[model samples]
Target: MKVIILAAGYGTRLFKDLKNDRNEQFKHLIGVPKPLLPIGERPLISYWVEALKVRDDISDIFVVTNNHYHHKFKEWAQKYPFVTLINDGTSSNEERLGAVSCLQLAIDKFQINDHVLVIGGDTLFYEDFHLHNVIGQFETIVKDNNYANLVLSYPCKDEETRKYGILETDENHKVTALREKPSPTDTASRQACPCFYVLSKDSLTCVQTFLDEKKNAPIEEKDAPGHLLSWLVGRNPVHVYPVSGRFDVGNLESYITCHKYFQQNIRNIPTYLQ
Candidate 1:
């Protein structure tokens, strides 16, 4: 499977938190990209890369980043044998392809025929390595039923649910509905759609549909995996597998909190350069 990471966003909202007047994404965070910013002493994205490296399911890792950071990402990824870096080719979001478009790049680049695992670049995942467990959750629906898309969901705090695309599932754990930052009346559950996704090869065709239908407008948060999943649910099965632990670190609060939380609680993150 190819793992595609969406890292092209300008991170405008994240700018204040990530860079001061002196620092940019390329500047050293104890000597790493700000996304490579360390939690303990190891780079943040390193942990995610390490997790994927151990998974026999992942064959190649593709990270789509802005042009300014392409060299930096290429440099950072050099330590890992399987990682590939693709430049988004410009600094402006208008010039860069959105999350779904990045997947398109990966598909075209690799001539991929198998399923792809796509996740937000800013997230930190700490799930136990159980490929069978992950596959088991969606196998019956995905293979036997031949579903086209799948997403990972987890029970999140009600307050935090407001920040994510909340999912509603039937008793069978099949996603029945998705609400992107739904109002009080719209949401039925606190099960949040995190940024991770397992997409079937057929789903790329759906992405083509999106390109034909929605390409005129600039891509936004609404145009990503959430919209893609919601678009596919009735037409095709979009499975959901619950992961035990993960965190989206986009700003200072989540950055510090997830770092401290994981370091103290989840398994110890290595100190590679310190």
Candidate 2:
């Protein structure tokens, strides 16, 4: 299996917040991508790299970023020899290819025909998010349904439903529907789906099919992975694995919170790193 981390977003919101800060120290963080920003003792993405590096099933790790931060990602990639960084040739957020297109680009560039694990670059799970366990569940589901894909979900408040891709699942945890940022009354399910996913080799072709059909559609419709999963759920079975929550370091406040959490709690949890 190959792992692709979507880091192509320009993080306009985060940068905007940083730019207005009065602290001189924040100046250094004004332009840094969310994935590369400091989180605890290391960069935010390093946690992910360390956790997956030891997995025998994972053959490669790919980080897809924009041309605006391509060089910065390249500098960070040097620390992890196993990681391959791809620039989407997008100089700014406005010119960026959506997350789905970036994923498709990596698939085409590497000719990936295996089961691919896709994750958002700015996201991370808590202590219990073991890669082995996650992959094992995916493999177990595949045994019964070859076309099934696994995604992570966490419960959110009713009012927060509009901020995420709300997933409606069956008693068996199979995704029945996905609503991207729907209003609170749209569904009673508070299961918010994140970017983590496992797509089978058979399902790999669906990316191109989606792109072809949505060619005339705006990038906003394709920007989030939820859009792809929302479409995929219609064609194939997608399962949900529950977690307490994830640390989404999109803005300055979240970054600080994530850093503090890892710093204080990492030792209490079992880690994959040697």
Candidate 3:
């Protein structure tokens, strides 16, 4: 399987907070992309890159970023010859193609025909979350159904359902449906779904199929991968892989928290990069 890291978000919320200066400590971070922001000893996305770089199951790692941060990612990508970067030709959030569109761009540009492992650049799971285990589970799913897909899910608080896309699964753990940012009372399921997924190679073309079918739909409908995941659950066998927890560094506070978590649990960090 190949890997695609979605990092094109404009970081509006974090930029707003950093622009407030916060005693001038955040001045340096004013315009950095969330995925490139410093976390612990390295950039946030670097942790994911380092972990996957060592895996033979992964073929190539592609990072899709907007033109605004293209130069910045170019500088970073210089150190890793194994990674390829795609400039989505969008400089701002309003001009940006949503996450799913960005994925389509990368797939088209690279002509990716293999199974792809999709990861959110600004998202990080707990120290105990292992890609080895995740990939193993995904492989098991594929063994039963080659067209099946796997996504990571972690339990979230009842009141926090509004903050994420929740998953509804059957007794067999197959995703029955997805409610994007549903109200806490909308459903009893609290299986907060993250952006991480292992999409089968045979199902790769379905992304373009979705975009074409929803050609006239509002951008909001095609923005998040959850929309596509929900669409996939209907036609394909989408299963859930439970994770303990994850840190989505969307704001300054969450970024700091993710950094501190890594710092305090240094030993748990993967060392495959060395």
Candidate 4:
């Protein structure tokens, strides 16, 4: 499986909390991009990269980000032989493709047709983050000519349903409904997407086909992936696997707290390179 990490966004929420000290997600956390920010001397994304290495199933790693940070990412890429960094040529969200579009861009650039794993650069799965389990579940769903898509979600019960993409699943774990940042009253399930998703090549092809048709039209929806997933659920089989133990790094409080929490508890954190 190939990995595509969406790291292109400007992270406005994080910047607001930093009080305009800096806008880059990596830089603001530790005077670098959010991926490069150090947690107890180890770069924040380093942990995930290392975990991916351990899995052995993932062969290639790609990070999609703006051209401005290419140099910084190049420095990090040199340290990992399996990593390839691509510039999205976007300095703002207005120009950048939404999450699904970004992955489509990666698919076009890399010509990836295998099962691909898409992760949010802002979130980290703990060592026991239910990812491998979810992957196994996904394989089963797609095995017998079944669903073409599966998303790993988490239970969001902290009165913050509106801040996440919530899921409603059937008895068979198939996704029946999707709500992106739903109002409290509209929320049907506590499961929120924590950014871990497995997409079959067929599923991505369908998404790309839809995007091609939608590009000429105005963007009626804000969250591209959420909207796409909702649409896919109706036409194709889509499953939601519940994942536990992840922090939403997009939020200021969670950002600071994850850094401190991982620093004190995570044993695999590597030494930060100077």
Error of 3 at 8 (Å): 1.0
Ranking by lDDT: 2, 3, 4, 1
Model 4: worst 10 consecutive residues (lDDT sum): 265-274
**Residue 60 in model 4: shift from native, Å?**
1.6
Off by over 4 Å in 1: 18-34, 126-132, 221-223, 268-274
Q: Which stretches of candidate 4 lie over 4 Å from their true place?
A: 20-31, 216-224, 268-274
**Candidate 4 residue lDDT tens string, 9-57:** 6666776666654554444453256676566556767766876766777
Where does candidate 3 have its weakest 10-residue lDDT segment? 265-274
Best by lDDT: 2
Checking candidate 4 for backbone clashes, the offending pairs are: 25-34, 26-32, 26-33, 26-34, 27-32, 27-33
| Candidate 1 residue lDDT tens string, 147-264 | 4566777777767766778888888778888888776566768888877777777666776676667767656743466776676676777767776656777666676787787668
Computed on alpha carbons, the lDDT of every model, listed in order, comes to 0.68, 0.89, 0.89, 0.72
Estimate the TM-score for candidate 4: 0.87
Candidate 2 per-residue lDDT, tens place, 1-274, comes to: 9999999999888898788877755778877899999877788888889888878899999999999999999899888988999989999888989999999999999999999999999998777677888898999998888888999999899999989999999999999999999999889999999899999988999999999999999999779889999999999999988988888887878877888888887884337332
TM-score of every model? 0.85, 0.96, 0.96, 0.87
The residue pairs in collision within model 1 are none
Tens digits of per-residue lDDT, candidate 3, 182-255, equal 99989999999999999999889899999998889888777788999988888889999998889999888887
Q: Tell me which of candidates 1 and 3 scores higher on lDDT.
A: 3
Candidate 3 achieves a global lDDT of 0.89
